[model samples]
Target: MYINTVSHYLPSEVIGNEYFTNINNLSHEWIVERTGISERRKASAEENTSTMAIKAVESLLESIPYSKNEIDLIIGATYTPYDTIVTLAHAVQHQLQIPDIPVVSISSACSSLLNAIEIVEGYFALGKASKALVVVSDHNTAYYNEMDTVSGHLWGDGASALLISKERQTDSDMHIKKIITGGAATSGKAIEAVVLRPNDRGVIMPFGRDVFQNACVYMPKVSQQVLHACGLSIDDLDYLIPHQANHRISLNVINTLGIPVEKLISNIQYLGNTGCAGCAIALSENKEKFKKGENIVITVFGGGYSYGAMLITI
Candidate 1:
């Protein structure tokens, strides 16, 4: 599979650490030192996951020569959903007004983007779809509790859209070399680490230590496995775009992988954690920096104890 184009949408509302200090009494220095997050974006009252996704797609269509009718598969990924009944996939299809195509929505926490791409790979392998659109977004502020000091300040809203083709659509298309995903729900403290119960606190990380520990271990491990599968190594990678969950975790993964610090790409410092959209947003934001024949890795570890990694070549 090849990525024809990518685009992202970030909400206009910016929530700085000072806002958290005033509301939750958490110091700016403490938040930045712990999570490396000085600020995050929050959606306005009129915006939600689907709305941001639609905007991302619109933005992508504006910059690319792709037509809405050319898309045969639409996959939407998001854990924080506005309406489960309607789903993000259905909403996008309705917005595009395309009929009789397979539309699917999936949520695997922060690993949702990779999982959606894996689904696209399956569809292409089975000859079910040629051109696919993968949309990932998270409306964390919609269900987040500003009073919860554990993860209140970490929530952000953003969305990304990717146009993927079974075959290369253009000379500059990025090739999807490999993709792998797995679950750790049965692992230690995996299920209890992060929780998002609508009836309870919108999003909470009661056992953040456990989440951090596993993420540090699995992200690099899966990254190495995917690279090895592609017959490449860490030194061959031009960029490492791990899940933008934490700056410390990213540093730990690079240290474990023995990659140069400059190869790491991160957006959490300003966007905070956009859930599934973080890595995609970072890719879109930094697309210009990547050159032809460069290799990039995207590894993710999400709240549901889900994890994944993909190797792409520009």
Candidate 2:
């Protein structure tokens, strides 16, 4: 599988650390020191996960120029879907007027993008799809309380779309080398540590310590496993893209892997943690910065106690 184009859409509303500081009674410097997020985007009232994803897909289609009839598969990844009855993938298909293509939705939290990529690759391998559109979006503001100092302040709303094809479209296109995904259920109790309950008072309550500890361990472990499977090492990686859950979590994973901080591609400072859209958006935003044939590793850990990694060649 090859990536033909990548694009993203972010809402107009920008929320800064100052907004959180005033609401949470904490200094802006304190928030920055802990999360390294200065600002994040929030979707407007009219925007939802599906709409954001459709906008991203439109941008991608503009670049790739693939007709609706050419697309064989559509995969949407999101944990914050606007409606459970109609999947985000189906909504995107409806908006794009994509004809009768199989639409699948994934709810793997932060790891959903990578997981979606793997699913598309499987379809390609089976000769089931020649062209695939993978879209991911999340509206964290919809679930979290604005006044909550911890989880609420850490999320942003964004969507990303990637055009993947069985054959490379151009010499500049990037190849999907290896994608590995897995997680341990031993930490199943940690599920409640980072949860967004419907009836609960608009708060995405998270146990800070538990999440931090698990992220620090699982992220590096899965990253190493994927790298080894691809017969690559940390030194061979030209760029490392980890799920932008928190600044500290990213730093810990880099430190544990002993990879240089400069090699890690991080957008948390501006985009915050956009859940499933984090890694995909970061990849799209940094696409031009990558050189051909360079190795890029994406490692992610999410709320299901889920973790995985993918190795790509640019």
Best by lDDT: 1
Error at 170, model 1, angstroms: 0.4
Candidate with maximal TM-score: 1
lDDT of 2 by residue, 1-314 (tens): 88888999999998998898777886778888999889999999999988999899888877885565798899999988898889999998898887777889987778898889989988988998989999999988888887777777888999999989999888888888888887655784567777766667753646777878888998888888877888888788888899998999999999999988998899999988999899989999999999977998888888867778888898
> What would the per-residue lDDT of candidate 1 be over residues 80-137, giving only the tens digit for each residue?
9989999998999999899999999999999999999999999999999999999999
**What do the candidate models score in CA lDDT, each in turn?**
0.94, 0.86
Error of 2 at 121 (Å): 2.0
**RMSD in angstroms between candidate 2 and the native structure over all alpha carbons:** 1.4
Error of 2 at 281 (Å): 0.6
Poorly placed runs, candidate 1 (over 4 Å): none
